[model samples]
Target: MSLSKLLTVCVIAISLNSTAAEHSRTIDIDSKVVSNHRATINGERINYSVTSGTQPVWNEEGEPTATLYYNYYKKDKVDDISKRPLLISFNGGPGSASVWMHIAYTGPRILKIDDEGYPMQPYGMKDNPHSVLDVADIVFVNPVKTGYSRILPNKDGKMPSADEQKAQFFGVNADIKYLADWINTFITRNNRSLSPKFLIGESYGTVRVSGLAKELQQAHWWFLNGVVLVSPTDIGIKRDGPVKAANRLPYFAATAWHHKALPTQLQQKDLNEVLAEVEAFTINQYLPALAKGAFISPSEQQEIAQRVAHYSGLSKAFVMRSNLDVSNNAFWKELLRDKGYILGRLDSRYLGIDKKETGDKPDYYPELSAWLHAFTPAINHYLREELNYKTDIQYKMLANVYPWDRSKNNTGEQLREAMAENPYLNVLVQAGYYDGATNYFDAKYTMWQLDPSGKMRDRLSFKGYRSGHMMYLRKEDLKTSNDDLREFIKASLKSQTHSAKY
Candidate 1:
């Protein structure tokens, strides 16, 4: 569907939902399990059923508050459902849908995009050659206010107030608790309680799962076998803090190198070599100088400024003008200012016109700003058409589910806690080198911070891709990442088996 048509449909959907609300019927959710469907992935045929619907979320007093929507694909003919490992997946938006990681990445049918992940002409779905469905049953979940999920209004068919909404499902800890309940409910309802469980989260979803792992175990005694984090962003996305600029330096270096905007010497070397030098400089020189604030000498400051400009694609004067406090957003604008174009925040490979190039930050993120054009519609098509599920509720691809509470929800600490609590639990950290959002080095730093003792370190694995946030959209990265995920699951399952024997 075209953008205009999709918007029209959304208008219709909202009208229909509003009309339906007039009837004031109590929400009684029944899992809408669709019939089995067949797909050929990895050159092999597999049969799976799609369950697309919402689960009514109620308060402790049994008052309906919200409806959490989810999509699931379970492999058919598994001799023992208990032995079949289940992977529950979600994408992080606090307001974004699960579609990014669902139809775009791990689902049996993936949306067809260009070689570099741009929307393809005659956009449609196809069997994912690299889908991990051959190995595990997957559930793609959308939290309240995202995808088909929504907050249930009062008996008068009116939406709840903002504070009431947050009280039910908006804040960090609030989100984890409800999601944990939904997971357990799904497991119990599907009779897969014995299945080894895994979690797959992308971007902010990583933060969600990190805290979720601990919440599941601590609150419900639900232990997860493993976790797969794509473009991990455990720490918050703030960029103006003391060390934040320094933390973002490696990413700037990577983006500059990818765009060939760096100095000739750095550009000529391999990306890893360039990254190694930048990492050393970030830790040894840049960070210390930045830490000095106004105490450092001009000569030393000039030295730092020169090297920062050399590594980053910005001018020395520009770098020094900001007192060496350059951020990822500034780099995005400055690096491509001369070209009258803006580079993408998620992937520097994508370019967009910035209206006029006189700005500190890019006019918009080309990669995600135009996402609604393709991704939103594609997901709506897949859900209503292919899955045989019908819904008139306008799917919330992304909403302003704010003010997003960025409290002391240290999810990295939660991840470490889960690992410590569940010895059998392992983790797979996957990062995209070109992912300007959750840079590779920051992910490394998060993992390093998690494993201070190195004993649980062996269980932690890492993989870096040449793509961006939704790395699997890249054809090669898709295949390679699926292969990696297959191996990781196998190793984790084996590790679980070994731990069982002991």
Candidate 2:
């Protein structure tokens, strides 16, 4: 049916409660038996689930569509929901899914990896003794067109185009609207509005959370207790701008030089200290070199080229010829070409053997994708066999129908303006040092654009980990991250409660 027709039908079929008129319907999700198996993790019996819940979906135009499914997990007692904070978690790709975080990090079941950080054969799954779900009720959401989310066909049975898909499903407005509906329905159904709510978003999901915070408050008057942004993306879209591009150079230098991949090094200094010098060079000299073009002096250009090569682990001649504007792709391939390996765009620390090893564009990290399959089996086993949840629909873990609406009209300035005006909302951004794709420094610059007041500034906290995009993949980092999350949530909730008292 057409979206308009769907809206008409939904309006007739669904009646909103007076308390939540903005939300369409209440979805009563029955608890299912997911898994019954027990595993000892850190000497404790860890039980898990791969159960699902349905939420009413609305089109980008505020029209109701089909119901959405989410994978949920809790430690042991479903009735003991009071002890646990509600956590709505999501992954990014604008096209990615939530399977990684669900299985690898916070879920009760975790995928196993070898000592070298590679997936082991006969892949083993284990109880996540470190699961934060012990403290929170975790619900993993798959945005539209990801995981099992599909667009209902029109009466004429035609599918939407890429543009239409984005306009109707994936854009910022659409995400916020859908999330508002989903959260409201969930709270109403569970009767947990007083319980603290939290959101955790990985990569582009950070963008989603930032907008959703405001959307939820404005549309539903629901404020989140806290938000966790893992491997955050720069809200600014201009990837090629001199200042923006130059800012990322330090991260590249840090990752490359930290690995001793760089050809030349002044000394064995702290990674942050060395990266500071690289950042200075990038802003003061390298950016100027790129702007000077052919008019720049040969000696000066060569000096800059040598510095870039020294810090980036690329050859001096190659750096000189490229005019020091080396793209991320070239850096990945060129850095370890002699070893016949390429680093991952998502996590440069990971190295795969060759393209044949994984049939991927870059050879070194196909295991990252392979690990997803390993996780799926475990999540299914845990949810079905352990937690005792049974469902027919395939759990939609990830989806690619994320809206990347980066039109010229959607400027960073506009997003900044929105944030500045809404000073009550705070952001907690965490980035991995080894993530070359969305560099930590890039996020720093993006934060500068936000006109936060003193109070709002206190609300914003940025954390950097000596890891990659999926920092939680590292056991130690995951623990630290969970602690960080717990503290942030407690503080935010306290602040909110205190403010309301006044």
Candidate 3:
């Protein structure tokens, strides 16, 4: 071969090798600086800056291992970070992105939805009237595998192994480890270490908070002032236990009344009144009948089944078929079978049209579907148009991170432990009565189990909303919940006596 031709072939081979070894740049850790903007909250005009990018996750050796995508809002001109309150928030999907909390409720602008939470046309966002930004600086965290976050290569220049990814951030323990570290680093880097810090978690986000709280205390020693849990799931609740069914009964009753599935007489009463009756029936009659299990006499079981049907708005025959235990899916499907609409599991108020109305389960949850359709598009638009983030990666609304190890998932117990460890740390649990997924009663059961002796129980608080899982989607619930949350933050910070065994 000629010398020129040989040289050309060698250069071509070198180019191919370089291209083959190259990977996409996963995280720009130094992209900390962001754009500043302003918005009106309540009657106050607040200037805020939005940082929408990825933050680096490092190993103990200070080696970058993963990237955590985040969208943070900081109230400007607060010269001293300690004087203001800082809230680090995320949504629960286990696989979910933080967009639910970011665009739906807490952010400056929110997707427009009706009082019933049904999406409206034109698919745009408006200034959030109930935004909590006026009071607290918010940081929305999208855990690894959600949103634009992904497991990055280590400092050794080797890509992440599946085992390393799972060991670092996929399961309960690992998620807490990295998230707790992310939060600590975020606060410290922003010069907000002395700032009153709080965690606001929705859905599985609450589960993350439970474990993350304890991790924050033990690993980082970064004490939190308070935590707000929306739709909590107690860790280690036996999935097959009677408690899960019993906890669901009240929610069924509430949903039945909403859809007029209950007896006509029960429908005539106010919501609180109807729920009061349902709560009574669940605890007084249904619970004991379920507890009896096979020991329940056939005659008494018939009577209890009839009573459950009356409260739950299902037929006596259908209730009996469930063997005195009606799962949420069955109830949602059966409640309006004749109406040709299946109820949503998350928010039973929203109705779905199943392909065939007789299915044992719904094809889709209408309420979550509505929220997803509305928010997903709005966020995609906002992230690029408003936040000025430039990325072509497919943003994850919910990533399927499977084989989620549940062994380390002891969220309720962890919350109790954190409370025990930090006497001043308070917890505010907010639940939606219409939420069938994480029933309010189940949350009550879990929170009750937090402190058996009721010694530090005073640190815990509970409030119910008129909406579903994403309570703020409803107009009235948004106002009420935000007001409640504002006062909660105040009370938690105000009560920092530094000696409160209270």
Error of 2 at 39 (Å): 9.2
Model 3 lDDT per residue over 422-502, tens place: 877889889888898888878777777778879887888999887788888888988888888888888888876556564
- lDDT score for candidate 1 against the true structure: 0.83
- Candidate 1 on 1-502: residue-level lDDT in tens? 9999999999999999998886544332544848578988778899889888778777777777787788889888999988898999989876888988788788888887877788866777888877889889999988887887777777677888888777667778788888888888888888988988999888888988988999999988888999888888854433345567787788888888888899898899998898889999998999889989999899999999999999888899999999999877788888978878778988887888877889888877889865566687788888888887776667888877898776877777788888888887889989888778888777877777687888888889889888788888788898988999988988888875456321
Candidate 1 ranges with C-alpha deviation above 4 Å: 1-28, 154-159, 235-240, 500-502
Alpha-carbon deviation at 71 in model 2, angstroms: 2.7
- Specify the highest-TM-score model's number: 3
Q: What do the candidate models score in CA lDDT, each in turn?
A: 0.83, 0.66, 0.83
**Model 2 poorest 10 in a row by lDDT:** 24-33
Q: Give the range of the ten consecutive residues with the poorest summed lDDT in model 1.
A: 22-31
Report how far off residue 188 is in candidate 2 (Å): 1.6
For the record, the alpha-carbon RMSD of candidate 2 to the native fold, in angstroms, is 9.1
Q: The CA-based lDDT of model 3 is what? A: 0.83
